[model samples]
Target: MTSIIVFYLLYLLSLCLGLACVVCVCVWSGHWRGGFAWDGSALEFNWHPVLMVTGLVVVYGVGAVVYRIPLTWGQNKLPWKLLHAALMLIALILSIVGLCAVFDYHNINKISNVYSLHSWIGITATAVFAMQWVCGAAGFLLPCSPVTLRKVLKPVHVWLGGIILLLSIAACISGINEKLFFALKGNATGTQPYSSLPPEAVLGNTLGVLIVAFGLVVLKILSNHEWQRPDSRPEGLAYTPLLQEENE
Candidate 1:
């Protein structure tokens, strides 16, 4: 009972933090960064941060916890699998769009691409996420795959999901700091530097903190063995449709 209560509390906290992260990024970009546009301007670049948080952080985080939710334990696994896949697909599409927006903006401004640590980590995380989704679908969703293979890959998939989320958070934090530095360096003569705790600086730092909190809560939920979906198989293995079908 205590575990269940703790799980729900953590879940609620994660949701709030995730939402705050998204809203913070949007407000920071839209209000302070001159709003959004698609005309290959700085405005267009703002969409990159907004979409990345929405997709990589919020959407992907939700998908990761779906399988572990106690409320969904008695339900059909196939539907949850499909829902997870759909969420991942959405995340992938949004990430691709975010990358395009930044790349296009850089090209238009004659700026170099993928030169920063933030860019390198972000790109790698996205690529790995895309591959994870594809391979997961093939291994778990496909009816013809060997059951042994699915069981072997399950742990790897879960491990990589957590790693990708951490990587995304790191990339976002670095990106936030990098942007603040740029803002401080480009400020007018009388403008306050980042060290002065400017509004934008405060908001960006808050977003980074919120994202990290959200990721930690999510990882907590996922790692708690007590919160995982109940396994009814004789050996206490997770419930999988293919395995059941083959056994029957």
Candidate 2:
């Protein structure tokens, strides 16, 4: 019961942090630096951080915890799995849009793309996530997959999902830092001397902290073996033998 309570609390905290991150981005871009736009302008760049936080951090976090939700434990795993996949699919689409926004803005303005560490890591993480989703669908959702294959892929899927979550969060932090540096230095002019913190800088830093906190809480919940859902089948009839055979 305590574990369950902790789970919900952490879940709530992560969500709150996610929302805070989005709000921070909106305030930083909309209120501080004009507003967001899709056409070739600095405003178009705003969509990058906003969509990334919404899709990669918030939506992905919810999908990660879907299996751990207590209410879904008594039901068949397939429905939960489908729900998870659907959420992740939406996340993937949003992430793609975010990536495209940045690339388009850069191309239109003749700015170099994928040159920074943040861009490199973000692109790599996004690629891995896409692969993870495809592999998960093929291995688990497809009816043609054998039970042995499914058992073998389960742990890998879980671990890779966690890794991708961390990677995405790391990319977000780096991206935030990069943008803050650009803003503070006054793009192409080098006006300010990194002395004091502006409101936008403070907001960006807060967003980064919230993102890190959310990732940590979600990962803690995911890593707790005790919080894992039990099999819906009778204990004796569970797929222990199949798992063991695959392990062997």
Candidate 3:
């Protein structure tokens, strides 16, 4: 619980910082109405806007994934039924890719419109995730959770998640492939830099990292892998809470 709070706090704090940077950029861009610096360079130095938004969004996405464990560990756990899991899983993937896209700006010329590709992927993934969220929200509410709705949400949720996961992986792979191609061209620098990269790109990169982290954690929990099994569960026994509770 302490750890969860820390991660969430970090995510929120980072976001606030990002917002501040965005404002700084906007202010710098507009200059003073009364008498502004005629120098046409305020916007250029304000790369923090890009950095803050991208970095913090990624952090937040990661926090979502990170926080899931505490969520599941509670007394009356919120069951992320397979269908609901799809919603979270897709959101994480989109978030990761969105971050990666932004970070790809420096490499855009090398990768050729990675920003566009990422944008499309992010938008599509967000749409599917939003749908999943609505359905999942309904599922959580007793009255709103209609059988027909579950039927409708379940299959669609899986389909959307599956596509988003596969495509997001593809997009991440593409970014790496682009870098590899660059390396092959004899430009050996691994990190790409761009003069005009927007705050959105950083937002995308940060998001990508965080979501990847979150996804791994969630998947690990879902598997209930050997590492996470409770002490009471006989060596190889799975965690069937009722059986354990009854025994206790």
Prediction-by-prediction clash tally: 0, 0, 11
> What's the TM for model 2?
0.90
lDDT of each: 0.86, 0.82, 0.40
lDDT of 3: 0.40
The candidate 3 region of ten consecutive residues with least summed lDDT is 32-41
lDDT, candidate 1, 29-116, per-residue tens: 9988889999999999999999898898889998888777778776667677778889989988998899999999999999999999
Candidate 3, residue 116: the lDDT equals: 59
Choose 1 or 2, whichever is better by TM-score. 1
Q: lDDT (0-100) at residue 153 of candidate 3? A: 64
lDDT of 2 by residue, 97-156 (tens): 999999999999999999988988889888989999998888776656666877778899
Q: What TM-score quantifies how close candidate 1 is to the native fold?
A: 0.93
Output the lDDT of residue 241, model 1: 43
**Could you give candidate 3's per-residue lDDT for residues 1-248 as a string of tens digits?**
56557544544554454344345334432431112221233232223223322322333233334323343443332243333344355544545444444445335334434255644654465555556556655553344454565555645654554454444434443443332333233235433443233343343344345444433443333333332213333433222321123231
